[model samples]
Target: MQIVDRLMTPSPDDADARRCPHDGTTLVSRISPLRSAVRRCPACLRSWSDVTTSATADPPARFHSFRLDVRPEPAAPSAAPPAPELSVVLPALNEAAALPLLISDIETALAGESYELVLVDDGSDDATWAVIRAVLAERPQWQAVRLSRRFGHQAALLAGLAAARGRAIISMDADGQHPTEQLPEMVRRWREGARVVQAVRASDARGGMLKALTSRGFYRAFSRLCEAPMRSGAADFRLLDRTVVETVLQASRTTPFLRGLIPWLGYETHHLTYEPRSRIAGRTKYSLRRMARLATDGMVSFSVAPLRLATLVGAAVGALALADLIYIVAVALWDGRAVPGWASTVGLVALLGAVQLFSIGLLGEYVGRTYLALLNRPPYVVAERIGDSSGPPPAGERRA
Candidate 1:
């Protein structure tokens, strides 16, 4: 057999060779885990091949080859990180300007706590997705979902909630109007066993007088009409324990009015009242038309009062018509007088026609909502995603 010997570049007697580079332990020649040809550091477990004996029959020739050091044992794969304790779900709509500061504020607010931020881009025309990507690169713990199109605020919030994977999830707007500073207090309440923690805004200065009046009015009307009790100032800014989050997702297939749904769920709830802050940048996505639609949805979803009121109106109109007809007929029969007021007859016909049309329209609203629910379409489609290492599976992805 051919005898091949190898030498290390530096003599082991030298300072560099004498001490282990990793832990300062003395280097020693020992039987390698592989075979007898390698030397290793006992402390660091790094091995270097000092000699190799070939199996070839070459008259016992001595061959000198360069020292071969086996690569350090492949590091044991790191275990996956634990799940986050809390998740902040922000449904963004063209709030690119506010994202940078909003993300910073959230990180600062949630410092020393294990939390994830879930950003849902509701098909923003602005650089909202781009900004989200940059933030994700810097903060790998956060995740984002981009919708195929603008699916409204409720749909976006649903998508974020579906994507969030923390023990407790907080849903809020991306405009920075919802204060991140209150997050800890929300969490504190959650820790105290509150399944639903609502952030109640006393007034929205940015929304102006008309919005405030309408908002207040809607809640007052909603409370009296619907069995589900909702506080006037309660909004989308709220915290849900994992149980509540899952319950909401399973319960709502269509776009849900969360302000109404949360109370309807009847979980142990706590409320925190705070003043609304101005947007960090950009205008509010909620327009007058959108607010009206939201109110309509809330009223329609939770209450059949409109339909009942329609029925009551029809009955009252019928009773009045019957009484009038009896008066006219009795007078005609008793006095043998012909009723000849064409204008009065025409006005009565018009009044009846208006009532009939109003009842039909109210009935149509309920029918329309039922038809939509029957269609069973996903509320929002996720076109793309980033940072899925921890968040839930893509909620209705349409991969490009």
Candidate 2:
């Protein structure tokens, strides 16, 4: 096995002669308008982009992998290139440090497969967008989209999905928590007729025992509350078939929690579990408040069980009050103990008042959601787009 490299710019023969490092198929070559070398493997569909200086005596590539050594026998090229087989969509926020290594991990994971990396910057205040541009210069298969402001995690994922043109789409985070090593199995499962391939976390050590229990509780509650039972530990790191993507786009959910919606969409779903990696970069963007809001969104948008629970509580309280009234009247007639006890009366009033406030607050949650949905506000707005929009819809058209 040997390492090899190709020139940034090549002669017609040199261009046609390039092959995929993962597999020994002579690559189909084309030059992009940006003067970048775009090469594709006809057999495995793995793609490459070269945009270094265009000198004839260009230096050989320093980057090489043991798994991606040059092939002994170069396979013949096909007549036409096929569409990308996979789209790795990552939603990023203030992830400047993690972007470089994560992208490399993605390439390594899908070395022989025809895939594109779609990175959606969810209004990062850091140099994340700048890093994306730099990386794009190095790899033509990379596509970056910048959102106007922080649209939260789910919206960013939606934006990337909307911009991805690949037949199979995989959504993950940029925080390195979602392992790229599992990508191969996901693609394999997708090809094997699984419309939705969900990645489940074996365990999370980031937040210790209490946080873990809380997360587990949320999933259990969500499963019971909603019609669709989301698999425990199911996460955003999952693959979606093209049809599944279309199905998701059809529903205008203002606060869509895809872990639930994907299952509810009624496709053949498969699950894979892997231990989540610890973050190597900045602190998590999800604060306590954000997590609570996200939890609320998942519950309220997907289930009516909360509203039902409130109603049941109201009825039960009413029944208890009626029984208490009957008991008091009987005591007054039989034992002449009808005098009101100040302490008990005060306690009863306080308890009843608390319940009333709780019920009102619960009702307000549903009402607010309904009112927002009726207003038809867009879940996200795109401030600036990073990549070319030749295939996927533009951000402007992706409103709501």
Candidate 3:
């Protein structure tokens, strides 16, 4: 832990005899263009810059170099703690005011169970990461991960799931709308051998009539198009067995749509319906734009029905045009004349053009997804990881 603080500007007479201040060992010097000369201790690997000998000059001039602040050696990594039976993952963003109560509720609900709480800060501009750090200081069993930036709610949840070291994992929101009281029941269902324990939102009193209608319509369309038994009002608040977690991580290497993907797995599942509570503090993070993005991810990732729909529409349009041509020919043949209208021709052309453009745009969406996948970008980047638990292994080791 010693630091070499003294200056070492060696002259031509004793250029090779400089010794390390910390260990009294000989220093190795490497000449460089910008740095003039770089000195490093072979034994300890500590580095220093020597600006006295410029490579471009025949007779190097002497100059003082700034000292770098000394840094302590990293502590040795300790053995990982025992794996918990259950891991609760919560992804938070700008919910600093709601965390303390949420943590307390989780603790009380899982009082007797061996569980660990993993809080993920999804690039919150607020003090969300600061609060997470305080929690980690007091609770050794807890874990916190801060992403490089906000990768959306699903990516944050996936990051937590990647770092969870439990036989079963439960994921929920940190905005306090998801009730922790239902946790025990979800655990009970897991104990009864259910691989997936879904917490379906029976009712959202906070959501107005328009939102309810849109939600219902989306689910119905999703179920019909994707052909998966995705329950209407099913939410991200759910418990997953270890196998399901691993499978999801492997399958969803790109963007993940958990609400749709989970049901598509067709695993043995147990559904529990509960009414959603209002946010404990602050406003809803999911704006209309984000909601639309999520809906697009769900539909695009799990189903190709949009492309099929385009084909079906094209076929229907072509059939109608063919019938109209037959009728026109029949009228002209029987009556020897036909009425012409500019407004009718213009309307038909415009309608057909709109349908063609819509079909092309739909095809482009699918192509864009493929292009992104081929690029193989990671879903999220972890800027910092803090915990006593060693979570999961690296992707390479896991594959091995």
In the predicted model 1, the residue pairs found to clash are none
lDDT of 3 by residue, 1-400 (tens): 5463434344435454355677663332544433545655445667754545345664334322334335476687986678899999999999999999999999999999999998999999999999999988998777888888999999999999988999999999998988999999999999999999999998755788777788888999999999888888898999999999999999987979999998999999999998888788999998878888888888988889988999899888877766776676677779856775543465567657877998999888899999999999999888788884454644432210
C-alpha lDDT of residue 337 in model 3: 68
The residue-by-residue lDDT of candidate 1 on 1-400, one tens digit each, is 3232334333444443454578553333442222335655444667744533335532112222245334455578998778799999999989899989998998899999989999999999999999888888888867898999999888899989888889999998898888888999999999999999999997756678888888889998998899777888889999999999889899889988888988888999999998878889888777889889899998988889989988889888877777777777777778857556653486578768878999998888899999999999987788888875543556566432
Q: Write the per-residue lDDT of candidate 2 for residues 1-400, one digit (tens) a residue.
A: 3334443434335544466676543433554332556654444657765444455544334322113335455566764444587889989999999988898898899899988889899999999989988888777655788888888899998888878879999999899989999999999999899999999988856678877888899989988888787877888989999999988877845747887889888899999999899785988888878888888888888878988888788788767766776677677779876776653475467657767987899889989988999999777877666555565555464421
User: Candidate 2, after superposition: displacement of residue 252 in Å?
Assistant: 3.1
Which pairs of residues collide in model 3? Answer: none
Off by over 4 Å in 1: 1-78, 204-206, 319-340, 389-400
Quote the positional error of residue 180 for candidate 1 in Å.
Answer: 1.9
lDDT of each: 0.80, 0.78, 0.82
Top candidate (lDDT): 3
In candidate 2, stretches whose alpha carbon ends up further than 4 angstroms from where it belongs are 1-82, 319-341, 391-400
